[model samples]
Target: MRIYQFLHNAFLFAASRMQAAGLEGRKEEQRLWIQVNAYRDFIMATGQVYLFEDYLAGVAPTSRPHVSTALGARPDTTSQRVMALLLKAFDETPEPEQKQSVSLLIHQVNFIADTGQLEACEDYIHNRLDYAPLAIAHFTTREEAEAWLMGPAEPPSPADILIGDEYYTAVYSREDNVRFMSRDYVIEPYIEELAAEGIPPTAPAFETRAEAEECLKSHPASPFDFVSIAGEHYLAVHHKRLNRHTLHPVASTLTQWEEQKRVVEREEARYAAMNTEGEDEES
Candidate 1:
């Protein structure tokens, strides 16, 4: 009996050690994730500084007293002062990855300063460090930031509309049988039309056709042309009048596309629930 008791105690001790090791591993993973996320945020914020500097330089050459003039006049004697607080924050609790990235930025900044190219300084700050102080300084609100970053939002697309590779194609008329060639097709002309309809050139709907096509192609289905929403499976259809359906998965209307997505999601959920019920019955 004593021998059996000893064996049981040993097994329990081993199990406890395994559990502790697993917990420690999990804690380490969480720490790593937090460190990575912090590093990414820091890099993104720092990168913006360069973009702001570029804008300033571009305007500085043409404008009488460039925007950077205001930045230069501020009590902050050096641009480094503007970023000092942020840098300090990063230095205090930097991830290993961030340490490497920051070191690269320091090297790039030193190289650009040595070259005496003012423009290179902006590139060093924006591209190398991911800092964007100018953007932060200019846009005080989230709405303003979004407008500057992504352009102004516009009216939502209409329902039952199919966007052609070049213009708005009325696809709602053929609702059931309408087939898309690809999700990547965009209608450049439609963007111009929207602009004519009083929407700003910088409206979100006014996307470059080539960029839209590239984005849609990355997805599985053809996007609705009107709102540029993708369909389930991309099908490239040729339009002789619009020249050709050069790419597959043409952009589509967002409204109708969202409806289709809802339907698909509901069907999937229904099937999943039915499978679960069957499993329970078997059990």
Candidate 2:
């Protein structure tokens, strides 16, 4: 049922986009689009009836991803065959919980009465009867219509849930406090040269980028560099290899000893960590 609806929607959207792009044969496309909308509007009302009259009364059906995708786009098809098929599916639901879930989903989705119902439309009834006229009730006000569609709004949409603190979080820091996510935090990297110079890495954390760079002026071999957080006074030194901030005292004040001890220590730490990982993997 959803597949058919999805195909219907896909056709509608493709036609709309192409028409917007000023493609040829727009007149025929427009006519088809209108026909499709009429079918869709008629079916939607019928679907609502089925949900209330039949679908919600039975055990719920499962695994309708295709149908969901089609419903997501909200297409309408007037073909008698598709409408009958969908109405038939309402009977397939068997579980109470499934019915409840679907009921909630229908409310959450807020599928309003399609305005296309202004057009007089009918469904073919084959040998048993003649084409039947659709008489769908529509809402007058936008708010009224939406309220009806959304129902009681029990579970609440994500937008409704993400109130003050949950939404509009601050990013970057300044001299004053700002709202920000954890990702907004920038950590400076520790300098090995500073470690060898008896200055502990991660200490004397630079509150400003200029201070870190001034400290780096002499030792060009150092991998740690400063990056300023947007709109934040604090500048952080980032270590390229470690992919992290030093989070230690700023060691930018140290001079280059032209010695290999600190570099050797860093290499040893890397090798040690790698070996430990390898051993863990083997185990």
Candidate 3:
């Protein structure tokens, strides 16, 4: 987790949240204060500090799309002060036990922007920042952010490893039948065909069937090869232009698409209930 990146994204999320929270009618200073403090408190509360950057013009985040600013865009006042003083405040101002328990998160954001080291960014993160007993986490998703706070520190695992091996790019042939959906078709045998046309590997395959269908935006084209080692088959996805990592909708038929939607919704509900139950048990 490149903390600077995470922090920037977190600022945007906080600003958008503040805007969504409807702080606009308040005085400008008051709104900024709330926004800044809301984000600051959020960072500190995580302790583990598991953590988007996108900014519209000077306009409030009321309607801006969440995306990172161009490289080197000067951060607004709230972001600047919040990040600049983040470690200082925690490292010095917080109580003694708090300081030791809540370790500092290191960042490569400055180095990347200053040097334009895109390749080096990954290397630096994996080599230096990641998994440091002292390093704080920077989460991207709401689930992970919440987990960082509610769950114990993440145990080191394989996902933390970055092999940089571009072994496969996702490509899939869709099955006409709506129910027979699949994605992340590995065509390494056809690597010559892809290489002759000069296309890099597609985005990595989705680990879930729901995500694969979403990318296809229709019924998965497939003969339905369900590869489940432990009765766990996943739907994968591949689109030339759109991100393969994201989930898309199934489009083969209305009924099938609705089925997929229902499946995803049910899974979400189940997880929500589980989280609530866990919280209740703890309480």
lDDT at position 84, candidate 1: 42
Question: Which scores higher on TM-score, 2 or 3?
Answer: 3
- Tens-digit lDDT string for candidate 3 (110-202): 222333433333333333222111112333443443443334433221111111111111111122211111121222222222234542233
Q: In model 1, what is the error at residue 63, expressed in angstroms?
A: 36
Q: TM-score, each model?
A: 0.20, 0.18, 0.23
**In candidate 1, how many Å is residue 231 off?**
29
User: Model 1: what TM-score?
Assistant: 0.20
Best of the candidates, TM-score: 3
State which candidate, 1 or 2, has the greater TM-score. 1
Cα error, candidate 2, residue 175 (Å): 47
* RMSD over all Cα atoms, model 1: 22.1
* lDDT minimum window of 10 residues, candidate 2: 156-165
Local lDDT at 142 for model 2: 42
- How would you encode candidate 1's per-residue C-alpha lDDT over 191-283 as one tens digit per residue? 333324542223223145555456445542222233222222223333321223333232343444556568879999999999999999999
Local lDDT at 163 for model 3? 12
Off by over 4 Å in 3: 1-84, 107-250, 253-257, 264-283
Cα misplacement distance, residue 138 of candidate 1 (Å): 25
